[model samples]
Target: MVTPEEIARVPKVLLHDHLDGGVRPETVADIAERTGHQLPVDDPAELGQWFADAATSGSLVRYLETFEHTVGVMQTHDDLVRVARECVEDLADDGVLYAEVRWAPEQHLREGLTLTDTVDAVREGFEQGVAEAARRGKVVHPRQILTAMRHQARSLEIAELAVSYRDRGVVGFDIAGAEAGYPPTRHLDAFEYLHRENAHFTIHAGEAFGLPSIWQAIQWCGADRLGHGVRIIDDVDTSDPDSPRLGRLAAYVRDKRIPLELCPSSNVQTGAAPSIAEHPIGTLAALGFRVTINTDNRLMSQTSMSREMSLLVDAFGYDLDDLRWFTVNAMKSSFLPFDERLALIQDAIKPGYAI
Candidate 1:
């Protein structure tokens, strides 16, 4: 049996965590108080529970409402830095060795900070957090993925920003928000720009929406990965458990080995999945799809990497090897260079999971 303690000790790689959605509730309350941003509850514990409860409303739109408070307090450079730093610290404590923390820079510009300033502040915070974690004997490598809101018109701008900072801390670009009306093809220019520049990007598709959204993301926009791609299960026929059939789109996704960033807890909270036990990850993984586990919103879902893995262990009876496979899948699908990715898998991930 794989214990939760064992899950916590193994190294993990995260590819779908949100910077704003993972803010510590205590930090949110403290910053909210100092910045004069009103929160529903002033106490940290109550605020945390409030976020968890509100996010469980079973609608993605309503689930996203919890972010207003977290993003509200993170207006200035200092607040951004603090939140980003604590994000790394929390991930490190949860045994995450490498992560790509994403946020929309445009949303943080309300406090007179430019997109460039937001990127720089987050980079500085990541550096500080890495150093602090190292001092405590925890080594973590954190990178940035600049996201543009799908409802907004600044994806091209955010893509350019991500490319400009490629040599720094930024690793990729993404577009996230309500995925219903705002299809991935809505930002074709940004995708084309990213492709031309040889940059990597992931699209948040097949979550709130269905196959049409995912098809546009891959077929039209050419995403390197699928965020919350749980809906790809729609294209798969599981009537015959002995031999399931895959549709064209599903087979193409699997044949090309496009990674699916699956967040079980967050998906259930947002009604993307009925429950962790019924998540598509088990079916997808069994069928040899490149599926990676993630925590979409740590605060809203009240989850960690260890918790996510533990849930899978209970639901699907996955063992250490299964956990290592998921970790390697995430590392391979990361935006890091091939050599660095291989090095982490060899030096850190493999050794950590070794019996």
Candidate 2:
């Protein structure tokens, strides 16, 4: 049995966390007050509950509405630095050794700051957080994934921003927002540019929408990984856990070894899955899909990597080996350089999981 404390002690890798979505409740309250924004609740605990409740409305749009308050407070450069720094501190406290945090820089320009300013601010915060964690005898490595809003026309610009910051802390680019009407094809120019630049990128597909969204993301936009690809299970036939059948799409994904960034709790909150026990991640993992568990929005989901892993242990009887397998999968699928990933796996991950 893997105790919660043991799980926390195990070095973890996160590939699909959102910067805006994981802001701490107290930080949100502080920023709200500082920025003169109104929150539904002033108390940190109540504000946290309000976000969790609002996200559970079972609509992707409704789930995203909760970000308005968080993002509203996150307009200033100081705010961005603070949030990014705390993001690292919080993840380090939870024993996350590496994480790729994604957020749309375009969204943070409302306070008269340029996209570069916001990105620089976040980078500064990440560095400060890393130094702070080191002082506390904890180490965390975090990289940024610049996201382009699917409903906006700034994907090409954002893609350029990501490339410009490639030598900095930016590791990848992403397209995020509602997945229904705004397909990945809409941002063909950006994807094509990223492909030409040999830049890594992931697509936000197969979460709110179905096969078409996923199909276009993979076959059309050429995503390195699928974000919240819970809907991929729709194409999988699991009449037998031992020998399940995969549809053409699912088979293609598995055969190609494309990573599926699966967020179980956030999936439930968005009605992607009914509950953790019924999530497709277990079946997909059992079937040898390249699945990586994640907490899409920690604040909204009220979760961490440890909580997510513990929930899986309770639901599916996964042992330490299973947890290690998931952690390695995430590390393998991360946008970090091959050498860094290998170093973390060999030095941190394997040693931590050793009996």
lDDT of all predictions: 0.95, 0.94
Candidate 2 — which pairs collide? Answer: none
* For every candidate, C-alpha RMSD to the true structure in Å: 0.6, 0.8
- The candidate that wins on TM-score is 1
Superposition error at 319 for model 1 (Å): 0.3
Candidate 2 TM-score over all chains jointly:
0.99
TM-score of each: 0.99, 0.99
lDDT of model 1 at position 264: 97
Flag regions of model 1 displaced more than 4 Å. Answer: none
Residue 227 C-alpha lDDT in model 2:
96
- Candidate 1 has its poorest 10 consecutive residues by lDDT at 65-74
